[model samples]
Target chain A: MNYIEHTGKYFAMLKQIFRKPQKWIIFKESLFREMEDIGINSIGITAFISFFVGGVVVIQMALNLENPFIPRYLIGYATRMSLVLEFSPTLMSIILAGKVGSYITSSIGTMRVTEQIDALEVMGVNSLNYLVLPKIIASVVFYPLLVTLGIFLGIYGGMVAGVLTDLISMPDYITGLRTDLDPFHFTYSMIKTVVFAFVIATIPAYHGYYVHGGSLEVGRAGTKAVVWTSVVIIVLNYFLTQMLLS
Target chain B: MIEVKNIYKGFNGVEILKDVSAVFENGKTSLIIGQSGSGKTVFLKCLLGLFETEKGIISFDGRNYAELGIKVRRKLREEIGMVFQGSALYDSLTVEQNVMFPIKMFKNSSQKEMLIRVNEVLERVNLEKSNKKYPSELSGGMKKRVAIARAIVMNPKYLFCDEPNSGLDPQTSTLIDNLIHEITVENNITTIINSHDMNSVMEIGDKIILLKDGYKVWDGTKDEVFYTDNEAVTSFVYSSNLFKKVREVYTGNIKL
Candidate 1:
């Protein structure tokens, strides 16, 4: 479909949603499923990625700052800055794009290929409202929660690295982290995560909902949805950071 | 009644439906019979508004389909119940949930009322005890029954079935056809069915429309079909061995 037609259908779906919002029950069910799938199941990967990323950052910082003149406690400040501004949102989005994006694509694409969407249409139900809206709502709502979890794990990983490497004393690490951190930085990271979550959820669900052909086509669509949404997440991350930081 | 007039539809310059038109009456089983690529399915989709016809007007009960607003279209759609070619039951939902879906969507029935309606429809389809089974666990015939039960759960005025017996055994196919016919008569629904099955054609074809290359080549009653001199239809109909045996029996050529 062309962009104009697609956009028109999207707005039509939105309009249909307002007419009968009683279907919010579907959204609630979807949110529950998405939270479990995207958030709870993702904890392991998030923790692993955060741990390794923190370790890598500390190693890189130690190698570069071998000059005895520079205080090693600033490593905590550097770690804090990267975690709050860049790593948390970016890494969380990448994980979500792989996990939640693929899930939405597969679920909706399966529904589409199997004619469940058509069945809904035949029943005087707006398929987009029933299928896509719940997913969009879930992503817009739960993505921030997932991002918060990501940030918490990432920070904890950094703390683990600080203690293991002894780059700074434990007290100095804690003090440096507290002194350099700004609440606004956390807020900015959260805002970015929210936007990324929306993109991850909406793009994949859109691709899946509009998928045609059989299971093979749905599988192809799911792959495409993940790849394209991840690319969009990365590109949007750059632009959002530039704007927000500026 | 549904009127499809001069409908033409094409995909990628390949015509799927070419100047097709037919009238499906209320309280009758109107079967569209043709080969796979002969556009019977496409024509059905056109009637259902699933695919847009490039040049045609489809009117349901004297209202132009294209001119109806979304709300009106939805209201019109509520009058339609479709049994898809594949049954199209939701795998994740139980049979009871699937049957309840339409009622929950379009009606103001309470929980108790909806359950009563679901059970009633399930019983009507002879599936009262199988409400808890998922689509995956049911047989092909059973799934088709569930599809029928779901389709009619809303008490729709128009019912459409696409290839109602495509994958069923002969016995099951006949049963399904009879069930659909009986339901149409009982509910006074204008039922349009797409099928190439000669068995279905002879069984429930109160109004039969034969399509060849997307054109309505023949439209008449079932008895008229057997006697009609349309060479194309005769060749198509008599290609079945069962019809040939019936022809033999009629001609008194059977040897004891």
Candidate 2:
């Protein structure tokens, strides 16, 4: 349909998804399964990407600020600021929008095509609430922890890279990290992470839940879910930064 | 008994079911047979309350379906069990877990009690030793049996099957048909099966409703099916050369 129709349908779906679950025990079990799927399964990729990106950021800063007047400690300070303010929250979520987003879409889409979702509905279960809400809860609850790990590993990687390259000493880098630590920046990063996590979980679910046709359509929905999630995250990143940091 | 009264269903302003009406009785296997695109699925979905009709009434055991509130509708759903055409077993869950799912959702029975019920239904479906196997590990007929076990695990009052014999070999198809018929008789469930399988139609169809191009052209018992001169029914039932011969032999038109 058109953009307005899609927007209306999305809000309508959210309304359905937020209902009280039929059975709390089942909901709890699904929630735990989702947490493992969305959070724990993502550790390796998050760590690998964050660590390498952190090192690359430090190297770029060191090379760009190579001048007699500019302080060497600025390299560490810039790495810390960039990662805490934008990289860990926004960039990490964009990656998850691709990784986790496609997974949710394809899985839910598969269920839709195969009539598993219909079976749930036939069984008097709220299919949307049972399938999507758990993912939303899991991502919102554990994404912050995942992003926190991103921030820590990212900063550590920067420290390691800077010390190994002799571009900046460990003590100077440590001092730069502590130079102007504002608790709110971390809070801002967290707020952004939470928002993006919701987007990552829900957009994909929306795509999957509404998927029609068969396997070919499911694949198309997965692609569309990832693309729309990334787009929404980027747009929301700008707006959130404006609201929270300004 | 499920009473459908002049129900009409449409999608995107295109009429799919055109004022179709029929009564399905309890403890009997009623089959809705139609060609592809004849709206049999829509009719079945309408009966299952998966699709809301634009007009007319469907009452289950004297209670109007459309008039029921959301909570009441859901409560009604707990009494309804559906076996989808694809046998939509949850791929991630093993056969035991899949069969136990509806019970786990709706009943507060103890784990031991639940296992007993699950095993009882599984054994009834002749799937005694296949609890740990996943859907992917099972053959087509086995998967359909698992789906049946899951559908009946809650001891539902109504059981609906959509094309249950679609993709099985003739022996397996007959086996599935007999299993469904036996279950209906044993549980006294108002079983409604949507199928184009003439074999299944002849075997277990206590009542057969024929839909052609969104209309109920003819409906009767298996014996009446042979005697009726309804063009739509004959065209559909005796469509193939093999069925034409079976009809001839059954009617004593020529020596076997």
Lowest lDDT 10-residue stretch of candidate 2 chain A: A68-77
Encode model 1's per-residue lDDT on A1-246: one tens digit a residue.
786897687566456544444355555775676667666677677768877787677667766887989877777677778877888788768877988888888988988887788888877787776666666666667767766666666656767776787655677666757775678898888889888877887778778888889989988998988898888889998898899888
A84-161: candidate 2 lDDT, tens digit per residue: 999999999999999999999999999999999999989989999999999999999999999999989999999889
RMSD of each: 2.5, 0.8
Worst 10 residues of 2 chain B by lDDT: B247-256
Q: After superposing candidate 1, which stretches have Cα over 4 Å from the reference? A: A1-22, A165-167, B250-256
Which residue pairs in model 2 clash with each other?
Answer: none
Best by DockQ: 2
lDDT scores of the candidates, listed in order: 0.82, 0.94
Q: Count the backbone clashes (under 3 Å) in each candidate.
A: 0, 0
Lowest-scoring 10 consecutive residues by lDDT in candidate 1 chain A? A17-26
